[model samples]
Target: MSGNVLSIADRQPEDVQRRAVAAVSLQRWREIEHARVVKKGGVPVQTDQGSDLPASLDAWYRSQPVKPGRISPRLTLTDDEKRAYGLPKSARLIALRGLGDEVDHWSVAVFPVMGGYVVGVKAPAGGGGVGVFWRLSHKASDYARRLSVEHGMLIRERYA
Candidate 1:
């Protein structure tokens, strides 16, 4: 998680900020990464969430080092959950921080709106902030729309 968070330090602010809008997306990425690296002795793979590890060697994979508590963990969509949501069997997920690229080093929430088949958007955090970015995919775009409708209202009521 720290590696992902710390990587934020080196990324283009605009990019990170764009992705951070939908905090859930970041959370999802965390979950995916965690699931992939739970063991050791597996083949190295790159997941949409980044760094894919086989189930066997997941426990032993060298985790990406990060500053303690530098950033919160990411949420993930399981294969079954994603399928239930009408998402593709395989879709990419990524999480990024909206620091340096904007004021107060705020973070963003993002994810595949639907099944990452077309487009996606960020759901912004507070004070009329910008949302995160999603790659073009139906799943991602649909999720973005749902986020705008569901979480968007909640966020607006709470933070607005």
Candidate 2:
């Protein structure tokens, strides 16, 4: 009998090609959403980089799409804002909290920068504002907790 073997490319049927195309489309959509969210100063729940963000921020990020225009701005830290906050260029988001009950209210976010962690707060009006740089994550977390308690807001973890 003659040996008949399907090549690797032949193994991929039209359904697989369709799936691949769909996957690419989904990825493009995600990328666009990620850019929009980041531009608006919001952290994306799922990133190609990885899920180093706290769970709360992840949840908030996931919910943004469901409520389109309600995504609060001024949640991400920019290069200039990082400099003002004394955060390193490698800093990444770890957690976040809203200062008020409304979705458009001011929010605070924590980033793990070199040497330690930094917690920055931003208002809806749009500004870098003030932030506290701590030598430890726990200390930064404690401060965030205190702020949450004081403002009667709920804080959520984005990293661990």
Candidate 3:
């Protein structure tokens, strides 16, 4: 296969996350937010939506579409899309969710940046990408673990 056929999957997950982070520019850095924890059905805990952001990025993100349902059980990627967007083609789109609940109210958008793609995630609670929203509803243990212990939602063992 040609070099162009090479994808981000070949790299480690941490490397892919790091490289994508590194590709962000000082100016664009101002565009995204961080440490924004939000309630399942409420606004973000905090953010800088008023902070100056690129018009293109702003418009682009605003115009992007959303898919509330979970795309996959795992952070799966559209192989061709990852390459087209300058992400590690091998790495899946990283989405952390306790379960697929309310996924239909969220969207995973891709914004082109200095060196790589900024994986823009939009949840119904708030509207932003990347570090903008830390959704508690979709947190890892919120679904699987909590249900398993509280409601007896678990896999029972069976002899072969």
Candidate 4:
């Protein structure tokens, strides 16, 4: 692994969380929030609009096109987000919730078919479909686990 990645391995937990949040594209994170809302049947929750984000996430969102005619923008997840969401050993299927913006801001909610925190939700600035959300290539769960552990370690180190 690269030295930078190894450095991330030693970061504090909060730093890892911050980096994890920053690593994902703005649209992907929005989709996660949107999916969360759908799973809750359009329930209300605090939304993370692009305006409130740090430079890393906010800067990227500024360059992307807003989905069609939607007022709020959406963020999509990278393969890494899939890895995090896919970690629940007992999770059979992960369901993607569309979007819920009725009460406040827009967000997506995802829930396991069996039920649990395996689901992740993200909010978008403009109303739109999950933007550029991509699934990870097929691989053994062991491989996924390894990646998760490596990622977790890297995150811990980066924040340390």
Candidate 5:
């Protein structure tokens, strides 16, 4: 978990804010990142309400780091949900709640790679606040143990 809140840091002149990468589209990421910088300072990148940020916030948003494989964790996305929530076209289902047949809903977060914090955002009614955790699961695969241990991810029997 990040001990310091998302603060306005000195962005090097050479640092360019990325519009999109493999995980998200260029046009979409800009709009969402813009809202995030100005609104809740990093929580609720988008909300049930709405976001209409000023021009300067856009720059600040871009200054933040966004890399490949870092994306919103929702495997399914409806057309409307994509636009409404600023979701990417493709996403990974990173949880197995209950029987894991299907997920009802997903909370949004930035899942940083290795030692970085998982900063999450929930609804206002659901209690709005950032939740940060820094450690990775001991049984993790590439980055996270969202599904299960890497060696046993698919075939428990090892028959193949």
Candidate 6:
């Protein structure tokens, strides 16, 4: 005769098993929803929430060395700028220094907003900030180059 042994889950009450299943389903749904929100450029409504760069770009930026006494500070977008870009309150703007010309030390600020990516040059001593919005990250690099050229800044080799 074959032995019949009840597993721990099988020993649980039917109601408990149903509840466990429902909980797992709900968690999976939440994961899908969160991904959908991020893909749409909206912040996910979860406890772990903040704006960040795409992984590859972030890694590249982090790997670069900053010059002494030239650490770039994280710039805060003004209320008007946030509204214009359709960015949420939690959005973060990053400025990577030493990426621009050696003379002026203009940093490159990049961030993702509700509809697209924003690439800009931090204002030098007496100029206003220059920003360009693009639909794709790759396309934004072109705008970055254009901005550098227009501003007479030479971007560090291989950086956009």
TM-score per candidate, chains pooled: 0.28, 0.32, 0.20, 0.19, 0.19, 0.27
Provide the global lDDT of candidate 6 against the true structure: 0.55
| Per-residue lDDT of candidate 2, residues 54-94 (tens digit) | 23432323333334565343345555444443346655653
Give the root-mean-square deviation of each candidate in angstroms.
Answer: 22.0, 17.6, 20.5, 19.6, 19.5, 16.3
**Which scores better on TM-score, 4 or 6?**
6
Provide the overall lDDT of each model, using Cα atoms, as 2-decimal numbers: 0.39, 0.54, 0.37, 0.38, 0.34, 0.55
> Across residues 1-160, which tens digit of lDDT does each residue of candidate 6 receive?
8999989999999999999999999999989977997988786655422244322223324445556786543355554345444444555554533324433555555545567666766545533243445677777667567656655665433333
Q: Give per-residue lDDT, candidate 2, residue 110.
A: 59
* TM-score, structure 4 vs. true: 0.19
Q: Rank the candidates by lDDT, best first.
A: 6, 2, 1, 4, 3, 5
- Choose the strongest candidate by lDDT: 6
**Which pairs clash inside model 5?**
1-134
lDDT of 5 by residue, 1-160 (tens): 6585543433423233242232357657877777876785655444543233312211223333546796323234344344543323442222222211222233333344445333333222332222234454332222223322321232111011
Tens-digit lDDT string for candidate 4 (27-119):
797789778877877764454333433233223344456688875445553433333444323223222234333223433332222212222
lDDT measured at residue 138 in model 2 versus the true structure, 0 to 100: 80
* Model 2, runs deviating above 4 Å: 1-103, 156-160
Model 6 compared with the native: what TM-score? 0.27
| lDDT digits (tens) for residues 4-35 of candidate 3 | 65466555688776776777764365444322
